[model samples]
Target: MDDGKLARMRQWMLTEIAVETACVREQIGKAQLDPQVMDVMGEVPRHVFVPAAFQAEAYLNQPVPIGCGKTISQPFIVALMTDLLDIHSTDSVLEIGTGLGYQTAVLSRLARQVYSVERLAGLAREARQRLDSLGYANIQTRVGDGYLGWPEHAPFDRIMVTAAPPQLPPALLDQLRNGGRMVLPVGPHDHQALMLVRKDAQGQSSTRVVLPVRFSALEEGEAADLF
Candidate 1:
């Protein structure tokens, strides 16, 4: 996208459509995401991550189909979750559900390290290529079940799960560092809540419901069979 075209698109987002998306605006303020997060949301070429057919509606502040029965979250939702995680420049973040890597790109800008997992090998491969082409050197993508989280890189400073689980995964809790925060969607497909979980220095954890939301169910695995 050319600089002039990008500028016009961003102007449309900040001035035109932002007001219509009430949930987006509410979440942005409630989550306390950096004002710059909105700027990044405006700047990123969301259309490129989606099918060419949907490019026209990419900046509409709504989810658009991206094939594989998956859809990228709305721009504001991405920003809200990123904000809830409270990322620091030196922190390492673990992200579940790579989807199209748009969220991964946003996280890369705020954190020192990012480890993203995608259940589908095809999606993981494609997202890796896209992020690599965009020169996001800080992001590392792996093809695997996100349910188990990434044990090899346990104790991440922050964790964000894009897909909603019936309940937060215990494995994810184990992977978070003390004092770390995690943002996730929890509940069924038809109804859900965006949640923030924090682990204190004493290893105690607590959860707070941030907003109503919905996402794809977290996949089960061999580990789940044990339950």
Candidate 2:
């Protein structure tokens, strides 16, 4: 409703996320998320990223469906994922799932540029329009198979995949520059875990399971050729 009320709700949501992080500190390896990540999370209006019918639930810490059989990630997961990337202001990020542009908007705030790939045409169009309407100039979105990653902008400084792939895609690893990091969910449909992959200067990579998670499967189709 009112901007003031929404701001209050947003802060409350951030507080809840902090408490949740503390509850799982042993597994997540941190009692609190990055301060910049928290600030960006608080600034982004998640309500605008979901359908009007679900705006009332936007401030909650849970995921809200955004149609196309997808849901904007839960607030805590968004904060945690963003925190894990450790995005720098000069970094170029490749986001594998655009959903409704909520996470894209967050990335635009933290990085210099963000190339997002969405599998659903409708979702891609809407997410692009929404981000444009919000004046997110540093973000670019294309409808395609996120599994393929965005080759045109290869060797990204950071990558964030919101969908779960049964296994890591070789293209993504190849697209990450040395000393870069990527965060994503990997595993089968019934079982998935959030994974962090780091590429060293020598081009060697290492992975660690951050925590258990569930996300829509990464889709692949001929439409990946679409710009």
Candidate 3:
């Protein structure tokens, strides 16, 4: 696709996201979304992350299936999660469930580096290639059980999990640097809440439910390991 078409799509996408942000504020009774978060939502080309057939609906305020029964999250959720992290350009982020790497791409702009883990080989490969082609060199992807996180790169400054786990993974919490923040959905498959976990500089952790959310279960077991 030409740059012109993509630019137009982005403009249309920004308009829709702005509306969604307002509705989100009204629902939660907040004033407005963080400006930086909204800027990233507008800039990332969501159209490049999903299957070509779904590209036309990429910017809509809903998750789009990205094959393997996984999804690229809705813009509002993405913006909310990113905003919660309060990332700085010097921060290193650990991202679980890479999905199609849309979140990874967004993080690339706000963080120094992003370490992403995905169990599906095809999805991991595709996300890596897409990010590379798009000139995002700050993201590194690995195929593994995201439940374990990337321990070798422990002590991340921020952690973002893209799938819902039955509970918070201990390894992820342990890997978070003191004073780091983690955002993830946790609960039963059908019901969940976006929980923000914060580890203070003193190493004490606390959690708060930010919003109700529904997401696919984070994959595991033999089938998840196969690819």
The lDDT per prediction is 0.82, 0.92, 0.86
Alpha-carbon runs more than 4 Å astray in model 3: 1-5, 26-29, 222-227
Per-residue error (Å), model 2, residue 189:
1.9
lDDT of 3 by residue, 130-154 (tens): 8988999888899888888999988
Give candidate 1 regions above 4 Å deviation.
15-32, 222-227
The backbone clash count of each candidate, in order, is 0, 0, 1
lDDT (C-alpha) at residue 152 in model 3: 91
Candidate 1 lDDT over residue span 118-178, tens digit each: 8877777778778888888999888777889999998899999999999999999999999
RMSD vs true structure, all candidates = 4.0, 1.9, 2.0
Q: Which one wins on TM-score?
A: 2
Number of clashes in model 3?
Answer: 1
Model 2 C-alpha lDDT per residue in residues 1-227, reported as the tens digit of each score: 99999999999999999999999999999999999999999998899999999999998999999886789999999999999999999999999989889999999999999999988878888888888888999998988888789999898999999999899999999999999999999999889999999999999999999999999998866553232
Q: Model 2: which residue pairs collide?
A: none
Which window of ten consecutive residues has the lowest lDDT sum in model 1? Answer: 218-227
